[model samples]
Target: MTLNDLSPILLDAAAPMINPRDVDKRLPDMIAGGLDAVLATAGAIEDFRTTMEDVAKWLEIERSGARKIKIARSVADIREAKASGKIAIVLHFQGSDAIEDELDFINVFHACGLRVMQLTYNARNRVGDGCFEITDGGLSKFGRKVIRRMEALSMAVDLAHAGPRTALEATEVASRPMIISHANARALMETPRNVSDDLIRAVAASGGVVGVCAAPFFLTKDGPATLDMLIDHAVYIADLVGPQHVGLGFDFAEENEEDYVYFGYDERYIPMPPWTFPSRIASHAEAGNLESSLRTRGFGEAEIRGVLGENFLRVFEEIWGC
Candidate 1:
């Protein structure tokens, strides 16, 4: 099977948890639902170690089946896994908080197969401020250094939750193409977390791909966003940035109500502020449109192939050179 023939690789650039035991139970259902892969955040190096062990166990189960789960550290790995009818689980970090104040840990993360790392989540960090901050401070001294280190390590720098100034600054400084892995177009949604048109164009100009998110708040305020609305957003981005520069990073967290409450109460885990909590859960129900959008939006095998994994794979190959 080719990437096009395989199921959709739902790349959630930010997920609260990566429990191997939980994923083991979830993967079978996800596979049955035509889910080929899931790219999620480990938060930091510590999280990566824990998540990696769990992923290894999950893949072990797949080893016994006709289908398998493979960790993709490069474009070749993703393609090869697709051809073999396997899911390519690409490890990503959603925020720099897990890294703490140290920048050297980036190298440690790269050594451990971390393919993507974002600068911030929804608040201020050592690297820079998030979109919610009142003052949009651009990349700090340390942030620039971090970008340089990420380029050297060949990790894809993400600006998903970064503020406008920081996102632009990083785009200008990073040697390799970066991604706003999970976000929407601000022009459409009018959310601070969404990227502006100029930033979208800049990312495209830099040969980077923008993964439009399915979060409710990112879509629109009128009502629950259906698959058509999601596709409409994708089409809008494609029109502005070109098709090759757009993809889906659903940002879907498959947690139940209990999980939702647990995360909402946990100050550290919940990236958004208190005001944003209601919208988070309200937005959850509309995420199913993600797959439907791909199928109904006139996105053929090639477009779906690129949106599902190839676009991200190409960028990874350029940065990681693996």
Candidate 2:
């Protein structure tokens, strides 16, 4: 099916969605609105895992509905979800810390349907530091080994939060084409976490895909980010690395305003950089314009299909060989 057909599915999956902060909120209405599937990040799962019973309860509700949510591991799974009108989920970990430096646990997480894993988050971990670090020491020996293990296991590696040196080094060392799951262009936003043009070209050349994040901070600095600017970043990256190599990783969450506190600064671990949070950073709802932008920019069913999920689906197929 095409994205036009898939749009309602995505919207349905996004309905009520999964709110990691509050379990009291009932998403049955949202599910009734039409949600096909959800691809939740590690942060979401970590925050909610504390309430295992709550998680089970929510999943049970979804399964009981016409909109069944299934974890996606391969292209076939994504296609099947489209055919069956179910929501396909691909569990992605934003950092390795969820596993807490234990390599053996990777397989355990994988067994639980954790398909995509990034090496680090915003700060340093046993694997390596993020782009925000003053001194990017590149990947640790253990980091390289971890990446190799991920490749061997067919887990898609993500460089979204890694430092420039770390991301480049990891890409060079990885035997497979991995993903920069969610990021913007440094050329556009100039954030440390944004991928550089060279890195973009390298990733595309290696047959990987880059998901342009819908976060305002990464898209522009002078003012609030809109869907137009978000598409501008996509167009820019497509110019540098071809349209097929780019996708949308809208990094949006369903949490309420109160839950934004969890993202507050503590500074206990690392110092915050000046541009850590860009000016005019709006609420997560600001991302709602994404679909409109994609459509307005003349992205038809095929490109929209890819950017929506097909691109990542293709990369997963390439690395997972499924």
Candidate 3:
């Protein structure tokens, strides 16, 4: 059995349509599509208390017993889940806003089983400017310290929605392999949220991987994206930085037309409601189609495997060292 994967936010109060605990409803699609693990966001620009609650919710899901979902705090945990026919959930933060001004909060969250965190969201936080910021000042003095502290604690730093300068600058500060969890190559799609070739190379130079997102707008300009468009992104990054530095992170969210604001998405960066992901592989159940599309696009077995999930797992092992 080949490994295929897509990452999604497990739970969001704003998007109540998604409930991972419903094994009969959603878990089958994920399992049938071979989604081995997900990077469940504990918080995105929320404060400490709310973030901790998010963590608690995930913990509750793990204990729910309604679904075979296990929280993977390490690579070993991931393997264990895979062997036992359970879905592994990697606790993640889409942004570091939960930490507020304190760097010690990173340690606390790590202790609470947060293995990955993005430095910023669509807008700036105390750490640095996000992609939406007018002036890309890069990381703050405190942001640099946060990076050092995270590295020491073995938590993978993500640059998904960070500003261009901030993402590049972060690579310079981060000694370990970092990730741009769910972004497309900006060279292909000229979105502010997309990662640049320079940033992609910088991330790869540090032995990191960039996961190609399946968001329709991020893939193409005007139309709903297709699986071909998604593979085009994978091919672009693979050709640029090699297949080992590429992976899949389909940042899927089930939101009502009105909850975008509640989710902290600005109108400037996000498209209007009823946001559609790429066709053919729209949801986790259809994600298996990606492998065939990649093969048809002239991707080899190993390259396709790396783009599937092994690439991200490799970087996780490097940072987590287990």
Q: Which candidate is the best by TM-score?
A: 3
Q: After superposition, how far is residue 24 of candidate 2 from its true place, in Å?
A: 8.8
Task: Look at candidate 1 and tell me the lDDT of residue 205.
Answer: 81
Instruction: Give the lowest summed-lDDT range of ten residues in model 3.
Output: 8-17
Order of all candidates by TM-score, from best down to worst? 3, 1, 2
**TM-score on alpha carbons, each prediction:** 0.80, 0.77, 0.91
- Candidate 1 vs candidate 3, TM-score winner: 3
Which ranges of candidate 3 are over 4 A from the true structure? Answer: 1-25, 64-66, 264-269
Error of 3 at 122 (Å): 0.7
Write candidate 2's Cα lDDT for 51-113 as tens digits: 233334445544565335556676667667767766566666777766656677677677656
On the 0 to 100 scale, the lDDT of residue 301 in model 1 is 61
What are the lDDT scores of the predictions, listed in order? 0.68, 0.64, 0.81
Model 1: which residue pairs collide?
A: none
Query: Which residue runs of candidate 1 sit more than 4 Å off their true CA positions?
Result: 1-18, 44-67, 254-301
Instruction: Please provide, for model 3 over 15-83, each residue's C-alpha lDDT reduced to its tens digit, 9 standing for 90 to 100.
Output: 122334343486777877777777866688789998898787777777776668788888778877776
The C-alpha local distance difference test score for the whole of candidate 2 amounts to 0.64
